[model samples]
Target: MTDPLLTTAELTAFLARDFEQVKDDFTVDEITAQGIKLRLNVAERHLRPGGTVSGPAMFGLADVGAYLAILSRIGLEALTVTTNCSIDFMRKPIAGKDVICDVRLLKLGRQLAVCDALVFSDGDDRPVARASLTYSIPPK
Candidate 1:
């Protein structure tokens, strides 16, 4: 198979340029043929009342992770937008730890890319949440 269009550094810069809101909180950990791994540095803002990572924080991790996975293959097509997302929070995330999401591209077609993501509390083997997302790829 051919190599990905974007390197980790390029994707990271794209995030900083186009998605400033999340650029600092998230990071690219690894990219391979099967998928990409992203980490969300769980800060105080990500915590809920009970000191657990909030649902929205986890969703953001999944969303960004999946989006980056698609971009890894297709390059920085900034207009590729999420058209659908379904996420399930299975358990509370560990307090004071970062969250990691591994994303697998289910399909990469002409107009759309679909991804599956699993979010884990850093250092844990079990996933705390899982997400399925579909993004609309912009026309060239």
Candidate 2:
């Protein structure tokens, strides 16, 4: 059977305010037993010329989603740091759409976590970017 997911309220409280990025820009729209749904609040700063979301902005979404996934499983371990990340920009994103990131834990170990993220522009079904990330969680 699949493991149960930790709620966003639990995660936010666990971080003790250090994870402001998640608080400020993202909402835990859904957390099923399998994974999570992270919604990004897009703004003008996230856009590039010709009205596409900037690559860096997409990268940030992926990165933060990974972090949130780790925290969801591990609790508010603010010291967990990104050790590696690989991102693929699959396609240009539509500016008006809110970016939704789906994050799943590939492996959750005692001292580390690996997550995969698929990011999509809100209205469409296709992914705009994909990322795999590893985070180091300090031993308590």
Candidate 3:
């Protein structure tokens, strides 16, 4: 297996510098040959009226997790944009719990990267959502 192009510290710094809007919300938990694991700290803003984490919040975590997973292999291609995404909400996420996303890279090619992310509420064994994402890699 090829070595990762970016380390977790490097990715964290890149996100902190470039994507400050979400930098504090996410943490890079691990990087593996297949992909990366990320956590999203849940806040009141991420919850809905029914005391459940909102779907959009979970979607954002999956998207970011997939993006960083691709970047771990392809380097800091900020322009690498999501081309398509399909997310399934498996269950209602616990409102106060953090979300953890485990992303797996299914394919990495010259022009596109395909990945899937499983999102879970922290301390829960079951997944709350699953997302399949496709990202378009920018030309060199």
Clashing pairs in 1: none
- Estimate TM-scores for all models: 0.96, 0.88, 0.96
Candidate 1 residue 118 C-alpha distance from true site, Å: 0.3
The lDDT values for all models are 0.91, 0.80, 0.93
Sorted on TM-score, highest at the top, how do the candidates line up? 3, 1, 2
C-alpha displacement of 49 in model 1, angstroms? 0.6
Give the C-alpha lDDT of model 2.
0.80
lDDT of 1 by residue, 56-111 (tens): 99999999998889989988888899999999999998899999999999899889
Deviation in Å, model 2, residue 13 alpha carbon: 5.0
Candidates in order: C-alpha RMSD to true structure: 1.1, 2.1, 1.0
Tens-place lDDT per residue, model 2, 87-136, is: 99999888688899998888888887888899999989999999999999
- Against the correct fold, how does model 1 do in TM-score? 0.96
RMSD to the native, candidate 1?
A: 1.1
Model 3 misplaced stretches (Cα beyond 4 Å): none
Off by over 4 Å in 1: none
